[model samples]
Target: MNQTYHVYILASARNGTLYTGVTGDLAQRMWQHRNGKGAKFASKYGVHRLVHAEAFTNVNDAIAREKAIKKWRRAWKLELIERGNPQWLDLYDRLNG
Candidate 1:
């Protein structure tokens, strides 16, 4: 069966510290981050807000995208997020709705 992967960026707040990651399940990953059970960096930096997410059918592509985003300049990352999420809203709720 085909699978979906996600490349996501989490932030502490608008323009705050950021965390980039790739996951097969966005909602579950975000839940872990929110509950301080995800990445150490994210929990330690309070970066649990899902600011941006991109879907991919291929896991390798998603991983590559995550790696690329992680190396992006802060301004570039913000621009990417703002293009899709102008207000930098937490997208976790949207996942359920």
Candidate 2:
């Protein structure tokens, strides 16, 4: 079986703090973030709203994408999220629903 990995972006709100990460389980990771059990930066900044995500079959690819996004300018990152999620919705509920 092929395992899936995801590169995801979370935000405190529209035009608020942003976070990028890679995970094999997006839903579980989102759960962790929502509950304040994920990355220290996420918890510290209250960055728990899922704004964007991309899936990959390879973990390395996902990690690479995550790194690339992390290096992006804030405007670029916001554009990325706005392109797909203009409302900046919390996608975590969609993951499980």
Candidate 3:
């Protein structure tokens, strides 16, 4: 079976600032974010780390998930990031490599 997922996240440089987004290609999308070429939010806010992501079976579910996460509070978002990416590493390299 082929499953598709849409995810949302908050990215910041070293400490704070959050950026939310959804993407079908997580690895490539994250690479662009890290390189400062993915989105204006990332470049402007220096949110270049893969702090959070979620997988969905459909794009609609992904969009829904993204919107849901976007509404979460900063602390909740931080917990979300830590849940999947405790160290807050750029998961793009591992996926691409």
* Predicted structure 3, TM vs. truth: 0.81
Error of 1 at 39 (Å): 0.3
**Candidate 1 or 3, higher TM-score?**
1
**TM-score per model over all chains:** 0.97, 0.97, 0.81
Q: Which ten residues in a row have the lowest lDDT in candidate 2?
A: 88-97
- Local distance difference test values of all predictions, in order: 0.94, 0.94, 0.76
Question: Across residues 1-97, which tens digit of lDDT does each residue of candidate 1 receive?
Answer: 7889999999999989999999999999999999989999999999999989999999989999999988889999999999999999999999999
lDDT of 2 by residue, 1-97 (tens): 8999999999998999999999999999999998989999999999999999999998989998999999999999999999999988888889978
Residue by residue across 1-97, what tens digits does model 3's lDDT show?
Answer: 7766658565675448888888887877777887877889778888776666677778888888788888888788888788778788876556657
Which consecutive 10 residues in model 1 have the weakest lDDT in total? 65-74
The global Cα lDDT (0 to 1) of model 1 is 0.94
Clashes of 2: 0
Candidate 3 colliding pairs = 5-56
